[model samples]
Target: MTTELRNQEITIQPEDSEVVLSVERISKKFCRNLRRSLLYGVQDIATELSGGKRTSAKLRSQEFWALKDVSFQLRRGEAVGLVGSNGAGKSTLLRIISGLINPDTGSVKIRGRLAPLIALGAGFNPILTGRENIYANMSILGLSTKEIKAKFEEVVDFAEIWEAIDAPVQNYSSGMAARLGFACAVHTEPDIFLIDEVLSVGDVKFKMKCHRRLAKLRENGTAFVLVSHNSHSILNICNTAIYLAKGQLITVGETEAVVRKYEEDLCLSGMEKATGPLILPKKSPDESFGLDITLVCFKDAQGNILETPMSGEPANLCVECFAHKYIDNANLGVVVKSLSGENDRVLYFTSASDNEFLKISPGNTELQIQMPYCCLIPGAYTAKIYIKSGVCSFDVVESFRFTVQADKTISRCLFYQPRTWKVISK
Candidate 1:
């Protein structure tokens, strides 16, 4: 597949077969104010009718671009994951592809039948029963009456709403509606599926079932574009990923790399929020009588600096400081505190005094702490560094924050311990 954006054209030539979807230089704009938005809509329609092209580059009052020059391609049997923070254009792009909305510029060409689970029960009739709604939704998705009948029981069984299949859908719970909608979409057997975070609405067991069904569909050569915040699901289901930030495409490549980039962005964003406008102290003559903690950072065993560390991984904490004058009996202490509602819990603590006292000169210094395995459970942690000169507090800084991401397969607690189990009696 080849995608070219410079010429405002995207072409996908499948090496072995046919191109399933091609998105050209797509762009979308929106207005912030409701009145201006309605006026802009009327003007856009009028301009289109008059055969006058309105450039998206020109932003009128209250207007902003939601997507700019976005382009990609998907071939037969390929799955691409769309990942981004909120308002990053993931949903807008999906809606554009699903034909629920139109882009202000560029074009989209999709081959074969398309089924979009962009919104849960987006097309369902409240007055209709689940079984009746199934027929309506599948028909809208390009399925014939006979085809819907053929897949009727399969959809109902997969949804696990047999008791409520004949009941009015408006009376069903959100999960039930989501399941029924998802079951209908997937059972229609479309050539391409555009899903936007719908898998997260169902129960865990049903979600697993959906994953299994998607895997089966993939094996049968159905292409998919999935928008989800769940990294594990994206990494497991897609070979390619697209990362978007602030309505712009940041990167598009292998799933692992893209997901890592997206996560790194999240970590940096959180750190920015924590450290905004806080200036670090520098070495100066006036501060000669005391110690000053300047910077603190964490790194993994592989020597990559981490803004976000994974739970149960080895990490190294490095603290940089400056001593303005010579001091005797100086001790440096480091504390890791977990933050929760109206409370702080000390997860780890250490002091240079516990090992050996330090004699400092008028210069910069660095301290390194190694954790063979950082078993602290996944949560936000703040690192506090302080200096004490013979029981007198010299200096302290307590504003560094880092997050530990939990492993999806594991049950997390305050900490993790390695253990072994065996059927000794057997």
Candidate 2:
């Protein structure tokens, strides 16, 4: 069944469509002070016992909203990524949906069984062996002993802990425990899965294995709600994404749009300390030098400004600057680097000097760097601009950020290159 969310209202395409999960006007609150919180909790319980209305709208001492009127739906075979900063109510929302926590207002309707892998080693008993914990956890998940026994080998195989299945779980490494938990959750074969950053616990090989298993489950009509800080994984797995901030739902739509909006918010929120690269001195163009970068944009092949570009598509990086002074031999450079701020992250770097030095007169000037086809990999990237006159640095701006989505055919390398493969007599 097709599912759509507009203005917090969930609509299924077909009249008889099956929705695996539905959240309506869900909200949660918390109090900062422990003593006051306990008192408020007791008061709320008393009010409930007396059949009186609970005061959820009004805030008491040190009370604040953890989630504010959030609503969404998930259908079978659908995957949604939750994106936000710390304390953005993502985890709280997931907990509410998983039935681990109740909302202060509104309700959640889940039609089928759900498996939540929220915290690592959450349900496992430290004193129990890995194998014994598997059975115990599955039983707690509402599975019968026979059912757990039947799936025991499958879980062990998936977790790849056969050598240590008999060992106590307290001795297992974090990754091992995470694998066991994930294996148990997936092997239960629930209709809906709620995951919160657990896929990042294991090694690369195991993570990929888990991703593949999740894809297979989706093919079998399982729905997923994934919360992760890794935007790449969100783009890779989820078709839709929801962005949250300060306990409020900011936007929910296509995955790329939501992720791009989240990144923009991060940049505006001053979350990333280091800006993009600076080829020259860090000085305002209008102060020390005589150039001011007014606008920076990325445009598609059709000349339409693009917020997100597709990999292998023709695009242009446009930089507009206002020059207060004239210069004879001024050089303009543009560098594209990964947003992680790690060494060796510069994907592409070039300068006007590579072709010929740019000679700009005084006043406003626009520079367009044309790419026949953008070959950069599919990920977040930042474009840094620099202008220099001979040995003196003029201006620099390093705030421009953009994301690239991979084409239909998966290209995993740093950049795509034109080449043909030929076999001469194997």
Candidate 3:
């Protein structure tokens, strides 16, 4: 098969001066070592050099490409988010840009000083005091001792570790270490910043402060490339985004659009129903009395329940149940989960069985429910419908999945709440 980027030459033109960084057809390859022990590396090399017939079993290695011909450019003052599942080369790309490692085939053009917060406290000395470690990190990032001293108080306050600054860095908590690293990097006046999932380290207020500082830097023409799995964080901060899957670029566009697509993919993956019934296996005919859940469905408005819907669209959900024996009052409920299996948001839930028709005697019966539009965000969500016949809650349906998509052209996620905005002359 022809290479995806074979026709495109990997080069950055001088006329594109506004672009601060250009990644040109970059690719990274790593050998997945079947044996990770210390002796394996030396033994493998020796065997290869001895001219012995190399069998596949003896080699026990495969060339794993962590990034495949990825190319993108960031102009001055642009903030872009790099999104992907774990091991999708987000960190590898960041390291390549930060000059920590070299790509196998492609080139990177970076204009000015790059401060990379790729791994928090990666360069810090654990045995040293936090103050000394701060100085060391600042020096590594190309700051003079006098400059660090001048900005010392500002950094300390910004990190909110004024008390711990004098203590050994080894004694600091993980969050404190991250804050110190981030604080030092932000003060380095980097023209291009490479951040990898460090914002989730600190407290909410500190994160807000970091955002403000980054905003100011952005206004001053600083370009930032961020990598995170949190779509909400990306939607709130980044203008553009790139989604990577299995070390290849899948989608790259405005942040909101890429986030929506990523979420939709996740939801579709989980939409397949479980094998047996809607209830768990433990409560099936093996253990519990002769009570069964027949069918469960997620619906949209107009009496049509689709498995997935785009964000801001009207939708409906329904659950059908059947009882083998006489059943009394029952409580029905539903829960929603994010694409990563974290509880996303509850669409609708009810425990009151006011209507007696819900109390089925036997055979088949259908219970329908409706949810209006604009409730859930543009991401993958799962619905866990439950019907409690006895004292405890029994699964009517366990984590039925659905996806919500959004328009790619518009940057609307959190701000898409149903509210009118009026603009007047200030």
Q: What's the C-alpha lDDT at position 63 in model 1?
A: 84
For residues 94-141, what per-residue lDDT tens digits would candidate 1 score against the true structure?
988877777878888766778998887979999999989999999998
Q: Which residue pairs in candidate 3 collide? A: 299-305, 299-316, 300-304, 300-305, 300-316
Q: What lDDT is obtained when candidate 3 is compared to the true structure?
A: 0.72
- Clash tally, candidates in order: 0, 0, 5
RMSD of each: 8.9, 7.8, 6.5
Q: Candidate 3 lDDT, tens digit per residue, 240-297?
A: 9998887899999988778777766655553355222233233455654545556666
- Candidate 2: residue 199 Cα off by (Å): 1.3
Candidate 1's TM-score: 0.69
**Candidate 3: segments with Cα more than 4 A from true spot:** 1-15, 34-61, 270-290, 340-348, 353-358, 406-411, 415-426
Question: Candidate 1, which segments miss by more than 4 Å at Cα?
Answer: 1-17, 270-370, 374-426
- Highest TM-score: give the candidate number: 3
Instruction: Provide TM-scores for the models.
Output: 0.69, 0.70, 0.82
